[model samples]
Target: MMNRRKFLQGAGALGGLMIVKPSVAFSYAANSTVQYALLGCGKRGTSVATSFAKNTQARIVALGDIFPDQLAKGKQHFDEINASLGFPAIDDKMTFHGWEAY
Candidate 1:
């Protein structure tokens, strides 16, 4: 068996061989995809969520909220964005009524 130092050196070299800068790794010539879920859509959630949806590489896949109104609002926000972007609206594939609904 190899010694600990030898094993680590081998592993590090192998891993380092594949290392790439973030900019190089994310070369945008190819299509990029980002998926996100929103658990809450209050003021803060809506703000961050709007930013996330605005990102060309990102899509909102799910939304959950304790309140029905908030959930609907979250859905509406993404629905409009998807509609404008020529994508299908993400509807309630699985809706939770409350804690008991879980």
Candidate 2:
């Protein structure tokens, strides 16, 4: 069976990608464990980070900010999102926060 990556690569090579619009075609794959981070995790960071966390193809794995509170908030928001999407909370999947763990 043709995996998703292979299908997309094939489509791109054939110039079929443009015909379908890559973003539209790949939207469903947007949140598939693609690890992202919140550099700020303030209002703007929360928005962008949450958007990706809610995706079916992405996961927010780590967060970094001068303020520790921002990191905690980001992780909390992502946890709620993941649970609402029927997936286990982030705490169940992996460790979050702190540069030492990275």
Candidate 3:
């Protein structure tokens, strides 16, 4: 029952609404710390974690991997990256290894 003209108008209105910014949004305090854990410390997981570290004011609190070597490597890599970003290095106590890691 609807013509193309009416459909296009409605679609335009909907798109306009989608582009509108929210009136209220949550924001973190300047000194607030956001701790995050990274599981499956493989190539993809490390890449994603690095992206977060590079893009946000987040701290990598924990790194987990089924393999000890992978966990170690991930921790070293994240620590180095975060250090370069003026963030603190991850503590060894927070790193987990073995298949039971999650």
Best by the TM-score measure: 3
For model 2, give the 10-residue run with minimal summed lDDT: 92-101
Q: How do all models score by TM-score?
A: 0.61, 0.51, 0.67
Instruction: For each candidate in turn, give its C-alpha RMSD to the true structure in angstroms.
Output: 6.3, 9.8, 6.5
Q: What is the full ranking by lDDT, best candidate first?
A: 3, 1, 2
lDDT of candidate model 1 versus the reference: 0.74
User: Mind giving the per-residue lDDT tens digits that candidate 2 earns over 1-102?
Assistant: 999999989878778655775558777643435666556768987887677666547766556666677767767787778777766665533544456534
Candidate 3 lDDT, 1-102, residue by residue in tens: 999999999999988866665432224344576889999889999999999988988888899999988988998899899889887788888888887887
Q: After superposition, how far is residue 79 of candidate 1 from its true place, in Å?
A: 0.3
Clashing pairs in 1: none
Candidate with top lDDT is 3
Deviation of model 3 at 13, angstroms: 29
lDDT of each: 0.74, 0.66, 0.86
